[model samples]
Each structure stands twice: as C-alpha cells, then as structure tokens.
Target: MEFDHVLSVRCSVRRYTEEPVSEEDIQKIVKAGEEVPVGHFDFKNYAIAAITDKKVLRLLAEENQALSGRGDPIYGAPLLLLIMNTPEAREDSIKLNAGIMAENMHLKAVDLGLGSICIYSFIRTLNREEGYGKYFQALHLPEGLKPAMAVAVGHTPMVQRERRFVARIPTFRIDGKE
Candidate 1:
C-alpha cells in the first residue's frame, strides 16, 4: 500500500475479532519498530514485549478496569506489544523513541490489515509502587526497563478509513507578506 493510503486508512481500532494475527505479520510489525530511528545512536534503546497469551491479556484488562474503571483497556486484542525503556533514560528521549517505535508498528499493522491501538492504561496501572504493580513482575523486563506504552493488535471485523479534509491549507508566510 502507498504510504499516504496507509496513513489515511489507519485508525484506532477498539474492538477485535477472535482471529489471531499471524506470526509472520507480527514479526514484520516488530521489525518495523526495531528499524525505527534511535535518539541516542544505539537502536537498542527500547524493548518490546509481545503478549499473545489470553491469560496475560485478561489479567491486564481486569487490573486496568479495577484501577481506572475502563473495562477492556486492551480492547480484547489478541496481541499486546508493550514498549519499554529504562527509567534512568531521559524522559523525553524515552518517550520520543517509544513513540517512533509504536508509530512504526502502527503503520505496519495498517499495512497488514490488522487492527491496532496505542494503549497507555497498562503502563499507568503498572507504574505504581503498590496495588497493580505486582503484575509488572510477570513481565520481567530486562533489569531496569520500565513499561512505556502498549499497542494492541488483532483482526477486526470492520475497517474504517479516515475521510480527507481540504478545507485548509498551509500558510508559510512568516514575514507578514500573506
């Protein structure tokens, strides 16, 4: 698919079907993320945990509901890609790098005809010093890597494409010359 078409059709999918995304597509998505540009020279600045186990997804959804009253925080997607980085890294750098990785995965998902939505509730729920933080132990991310964000992926029954709007155009006149 063309890059513009991919961006035009990409949307946040909140519901998914029972079908699971293929491992090949999953690897491609992860590969896209891995290929994202790094902020600090080393491209290994982030880690990705691809959770496909129903038990783990259910646990995360239940815990997220209990914490934020948002039921099905992961939208029942069959796969959850948790992006992480060490807490010692600069906040801006970590967030920027994670966003780049996630956007890459998101675009890849779109290209593969899979549904995906970037989720934050999981990270928020797991960041606590008490309560749901226990679930973080199960992730066992390398030493200091902290959960930054999550991307839920699976097959969707319907594909929605965003409508293009041309009501406005860019005005690059900074010198007041109209």
Candidate 2:
C-alpha cells in the first residue's frame, strides 16, 4: 500500500476478529519496530516481544480489568507486540523510543491490512501492581527490560476507508523568513 493510503486509513481498531495474524506478518511488524530510530543511537536498550498465547492474553486482560475496571483492555486482539526498555534508560528516552516503535509497528500493520491499536493502560496498571513481577517472568523478557508500550494486532471485519484531510491539531509555521 502507498504510504499516504496507509496513513489515511490508520486508526485505532477496538474490535477484532478471531483470526490470528500470520507469523510472517508478525515478523514484519517487529522488524518495523526494530528499524525505528532511537535516542542516542541506543537501540540495544530496547526490545520487542510478539505475544500470541491465549492464556497470557487472558491473564493480561483480567489483570487490567482488576486494576483499571476496564473490560478487555486489549480489545480482544489476537496478538500484542510489546515494546520494552531497560530501566537504566532515561525516562524521557524510554517513552520516546517506545512511541516511535509502536507507531512504526502500527503503521506496518495497517500496510499489511491488519487492524492494530496502541495500548498503554495495561502496562500502566501492571507497573502499579505489586505482583507485576510475575507478568514480567511470564513474558520471559530479557533481563533488565520492562514493558513500556504495546500494539494490539489482529484481523478485523471493519473496512478501512480513506479519511479526508483535516487539521486536527493546532499548528503554527515559521517559514525561516522573518
């Protein structure tokens, strides 16, 4: 798909079908994450995990619901591409890198004709919970890496439509000339 088309159709998909995302597409999405720019050229400080286990997904939804009172925080997506960062990284850098990685993966999903939504509440709740260590162990992340963000991915019944251009955010341009 063309980059403009992908950008036009990209959106947060809250509903997903039961069909699982193929491994090839999953790898492609992860590669997108891996290829993103990072702070201080410190790519080694970040990692990506592609999670598809049903049991683990259920546990994450349950835990998120318990913590935030939101039902199905993952929106029933069949896969989650989790972005993790080392604790030693600066807090601002961690967030910046994770956002970049998530956006890259999300756009890749759109390009692949899959639905995706960037998630944060689940990770926030887990980070606040006292038993969050178990989740890290369950995910088997490399030592020192912690979940920073995630992009839930799956097939969706909804069709993507080209969105009309709009200035949704306030902007001011200084054209390099007084």
Candidate 3:
C-alpha cells in the first residue's frame, strides 16, 4: 500500500476480530519498527517484545484496569509489541526512539490491513503494579531494560475514522505579529 494511503487509513482500533495476524505480516511490521531512525550515537539500548499469548494478554489487561482504573486498556488486541529501554539510556533518547519505532509499527500494521494502537499507559501500569517482575522476566528483556510503551495489533472489522482538518493552524512570527 502507498505510504499516504496507510497514513490516511490508520486509526486507534479499540476492538479486534479473532483472526490472528499472519506470520509474514508480523515479520514485516517488526522489520519496519527495527528500521526506524535512531540517533547518530547508535545507542542500541532498546528492545521490542512481540507477545501473542492469550493468558499474558489477559493478565496485562486486568492489571491495566486495576492500575489505571480503565477497562480493557489493551483494547482486546491479540498482539502487544512492548517497547523497552535500558535504565542507563537517557530519558529523552528513549522517548524519541520509542516514538519513532511506534509510529513505524502503526503505519506498517495499517499497510498490512491490520489494526494497531500505541499504548503507553500499559507500561505505566506494569511499572506501578506489584508482582509484575515475573512477567517482565518472561519477556527476557535485556539487563536493565524496562517497557516504555506498547503497540497493540490485531485484525479488526472497525473502519478508520475520517481525518478532519483543523479549522485554525498555529503560526509563529518573528516580530510577534501575524
């Protein structure tokens, strides 16, 4: 699919069908994320955990509800691509890299006719809640690495919403005059 088309159709999908994403599509999505732009310093301090296990998904969804006080934080998507960063990495770099990777994955999912949503609250819940160390360990994250965000992906029947243009665009003027 064309890049513009993918961007246009991409939306935050809160519900998904039971159809599992194909392995080939999963590979392509992961490759897109890995190809995102990292800083020139090449600080290889990030990792992605691609999870498709139903039990773990249920556990995380429950934890999210308890910690965030929101129902179905993952939105029932089948796959959870967790973006992790090492503790030693700078916070700014982590945010920048994670954002780039997440966007790439989201667009890739759309291009492949899958649905995706970037979720950071799940990571916050994981960090804030108790007894999650085992879950983190199960992911086998690199030493000191912790989840920064996630991308929930799956097959969905929901249609993408129309992109409405903003009525007024913000502008900057050198002399404080428009």
Instruction: Output the number of the lDDT-best candidate.
Output: 2
lDDT of 3: 0.79
Number of backbone-clashing residue pairs for each candidate, in the order shown: 0, 0, 0
Give the per-residue lDDT of model 3 (tens digit) for 1-178: 8776676678899999878888888889888889988875544788888888888788777766766788887788888888888776677688788888998999999988889999887677678654343466566555677888789999998876556645487786588665
> For model 1, how many clashes?
0
TM-score of 3: 0.86
Candidate 1 at residue 31, lDDT?
93
Q: For model 3, which pairs clash?
A: none
Against the reference, the lDDT scores of all candidates come to 0.81, 0.89, 0.79
CA error at residue 36 for candidate 1, angstroms: 0.8
Q: Comparing 1 and 2 by lDDT, which wins? A: 2
Single out the weakest 10-residue window by summed lDDT for candidate 3. Answer: 129-138
Q: Which ten residues in a row have the lowest lDDT in candidate 1?
A: 129-138
lDDT of 3 at 144: 78
Work out the TM-score per prediction.
Answer: 0.88, 0.95, 0.86
lDDT of 1 at 41: 66
Give the range of the ten consecutive residues with the poorest summed lDDT in model 2.
128-137
lDDT per residue for candidate 1 within 2-82, as digits (tens), equals 888888889899989989889899999999888888876655557898889887788787777777677888788999998
